[model samples]
Target: MNVSEPDSSFALVREFILLGFSCEWKIQILLFLLFTTTYALTITGNGAIVCALWCDQRLHIPMYIFLGSFSFLEICYVSSTVPKMLVNFLSDKTISFAGCFLQFYFFFSLGTSECFLLAIMAFDRYLAICCPLHYPNIMTGHLCTKMVITCWVCGFLWFLIPIVLISRMPFCGPNIIDHVVCDPGPLFALVCASAPTIQLLCYTLSSLVIFGNFLFILGSYTLVLLAVLSMPSAIGRHKAFSTCGSHLAVVSLFYGSLMVMYVSPGLGHSARIQKVTTSFYAMVTPLFNPLIYSLRNKEIKAALRKVLGSFNII
Candidate 1:
């Protein structure tokens, strides 16, 4: 499709009406309240995690560095979609095409970045667990920085492909996205008639990236588990398992729900199911990450305590 040419023959949609969770005022109000609480908790939880890692000298390792990056990304990820949806629920249920695209851009960027970041985190764990003596030299500050930069660069590049493809498609008919926020799935569905081949190709390419990262992460964790099992001390085994458990749980939740929502029979999936699964990865997972890491891990909790205690605020 020639995206550069503005075809006046085709109808142009000025804005997209987001079909939020519900049309009923009461339900909308309830959803607003519920999501408001989730958003607040997500911010607080992730913010605390980031601050704890930043301030604590004990968390100067590559693992915590990745955790801090994860927290920050989760904040941006949730902020990109949730805040706008909240406002729409209370006021106008409309978003400009530009706004929708921008939302998609940030969401896609962060989501893709997370896949790489998680893999990097798993690799970090593998190095730390499998080669404990060389962990420091291997995952040095410079190398960690490079890995983080690569995560962001790869994420933005991967996301650009879909955005470019979607931009080329004409959106002339109904502009109602049947979800609380703008996402690639609904967006592609909206323009399916204009460029089915492009949509299919983009979707297939994205699926490959997602599944490929999942397999890589799984393989890293498999090696990690094997290494952990070889340790004779029960305490050592527990500590090794504890380090990656939070990340593993999060990966399962994020990628599991994502696969269920997108990789399944798209025609058979109900809108309600998609909305629920979307909420899992998009909204719920962010909230759970900090909770899982902070509540389950001793290092983060001790760091949080130390930071809070320094101010006599704990």
Candidate 2:
């Protein structure tokens, strides 16, 4: 049904012109080069992790498995918006309504997946640290695979209803999307008719995902921390801290920028600010996650060396 306001004369919008960063050409070109470099690094960093995990057998434990999955998801997560954004930087980029909706779906879907993945990672850490005896039993290969599948499935399912509801609304005019991505706030602003119900539902769903998994992660790490502190050996405690520290660092980076971009006041209100904030979570986060895991992690570094040495690339 093509829903539109009865009294309005505006035609249905077929496309949205993403007016990204209104700046001088010199600035635009600089940003393009900067972002392109970051994107390349992000892909290579995450891709290298996947390759290392595939080639190295010693790192085939549950923790590395989760790390590999998270890296792959990070690649997808950043790629969902970065490439198109890069193209838009150099040209008058416009996206059809269908394309916009797809971008919105995959971007948020993958992001939601990260929330669950983080929680799962915490749970893995908790099991390994808090219940070492049962860690192997609880987080077995089959169960780990199932949990991985659950994260992906749940993440994709998380935002399906909200996107569908938004798409069905009568976006009858103002084809300009003031930001680089097809975010919910900007799209909601363009609805022709009253949509408070859907808007509220969308926000509720988003909060449920963000806060729900956030709480789970918090709980998991709390247990892990207490267990680590209680350990008798300094070596054991230091090892525990090292593992949890990397995961926590990533969790902080992901949720910090995300809350600023998506959950803050006046969401999608300021185009220029939104663009910068989104870049951090989408582009910067992905690029840094691999570095956090590999650089801080001796196991990952060893695996990387083995992988590189096998190929004689380094």
Candidate 3:
């Protein structure tokens, strides 16, 4: 695996061949159609949520603000990889070295931001459910905006050092990436040197982002659950559960797949498993977010109706 000696200069790698799937033409066609439909629905679903949040004045509160921001993030997140994957299925799979790293940076950055945002969203729900009296004063418009901005900034900056370190490591011939996306594991495997330090850094950051946010979310929801259970009225309990249910489901879908892929990177999983797991979070989760949030929550559903109705009339 070592491509360079201690004193040797790093070799320049111009491009990478993405061996997306080693399947037949028919299988590729089937997968292409399946992913195309999934991507279309994902965009439409997440886009509707974003539009609904914008057009409806009723959803202008802190909760919906976070939800809208997350929906928008989902659109960007899925866009970072799915388009290239679809193209790879049909045509040349070659991606320039810069293009690969750019994809790597954005994909990981956006995903990191998602982890932060999800944690923040869970905290928002906790405040709303557990501290109803102080919720409005605590989560003001200004604070919500600040939190959203912080998430984006921190997310984009999270993997800067690791990406730089890994990018500098020389890549040898047979410059091929096994996975659909320019993921860290596959990218690491391509490295010409035994970059233990860089590999550790990447995995550490991934673990911290995934596990740290997950723990924060878990703690927030635990308190929320306790508060909800103690509510005096049965109707109050049901309402509280209903509001938190969608978020919990989304969190489950997101963090569950992430932990499996990242927490133990390149452990026992094969390339196919990695692709499937990554697709679940990258493609499937985005498609489900709007549905999960909209179906379970009356406000989101109503907002969608309002947005769609206006469109219909026009």
Candidate 4:
């Protein structure tokens, strides 16, 4: 039945029941343990990256700054949803209207910022690799800071209108979101009215952020690839590929799942596929990002070791 305020003329849902993983109690416990461990590791790994970058003077350059910002974003991204998810695993899976929208906003906004930052990072690498002589003059410290700020501002603003519109829409009873998070799909399904305009707007915004940034990253890396290939020294080529490799891996992990979820939803995929894909991009990617960067990057490893040694933890 519809659950609206007594004073309201129309019926509306005040809280949403997030239908998180339909499993037995034992499975829920196991999943909670798994997610809790994952969340802890994700936070620790990304936090370490930020600290390493902040403490190391050698890493105070544009590339490392971008890395630090991205790592911080990962921490925020995972935190925005994981804590509530962990709570729901052992407790009630219900979320108030305001809380649900807040989660939805932060999660998508942070994700959008990540996409922009990734593309910006690719551009930075492209400039550094392809135009080494002018790289210093081009990517200045002031400019790098500006770009990072722009990524965050744009990301946060991009979905504001769409989310506001969606939140204002009437949500009738049986307010059950099928997936784990307050995703647009499940929320859209719960809307009492046929909100085609709002749905289209959300899809458009998501597509623009996901596809637009993906294409930009692709183009930047394509130029980087050509520049690396044309280098006379094999060492130079290997170094170029090595620097770009981690970024590419992250891009693949993030965009692959995103395309499956947003860009091509009509691929006859199942809800399980959707959940798994979301889990990969949302939680798994953040956990793996620090490992991918630190393992592949000698500088990052050195910095991390330095940080650890200073604390006598290594």
lDDT of 2 at 244: 89
- Sort by lDDT, top down from the best: 3, 4, 2, 1
What TM-score would candidate 1 get against the native?
Answer: 0.94
TM-score of each: 0.94, 0.95, 0.95, 0.96
| Lowest lDDT 10-residue stretch of candidate 2 | 261-270
* Alpha carbon deviation, residue 262, candidate 2 (Å): 2.8
TM-score of predicted model 3? 0.95
Which of 1 and 3 is ahead in lDDT? 3
**Model 1: runs farther than 4 Å from truth?**
1-9, 265-267
Candidate 3 per-residue C-alpha lDDT over 84-143 given as tens digits, one digit per residue, 9 for 90 to 100? 999999999999999999999999999999999999999999999988899999999999
lDDT of each: 0.86, 0.89, 0.92, 0.91
Better of 2 and 4 by lDDT: 4
Regions more than 4 Å wrong, model 2: 1-8, 266-269
The digit string of per-residue lDDT tens for model 1 on 180-275 reads 778777787777366666667766767877898899999999999999999999999998888789889999988988788666645667778877
Q: Cα miss at 103, model 4 (Å)?
A: 0.4
Backbone clash pairs in model 1 (N, Cα, C under 3 Å; residues 3+ apart or in different chains), count? 0
Cα TM-score of candidate 4: 0.96
Off by over 4 Å in 4: 1-9
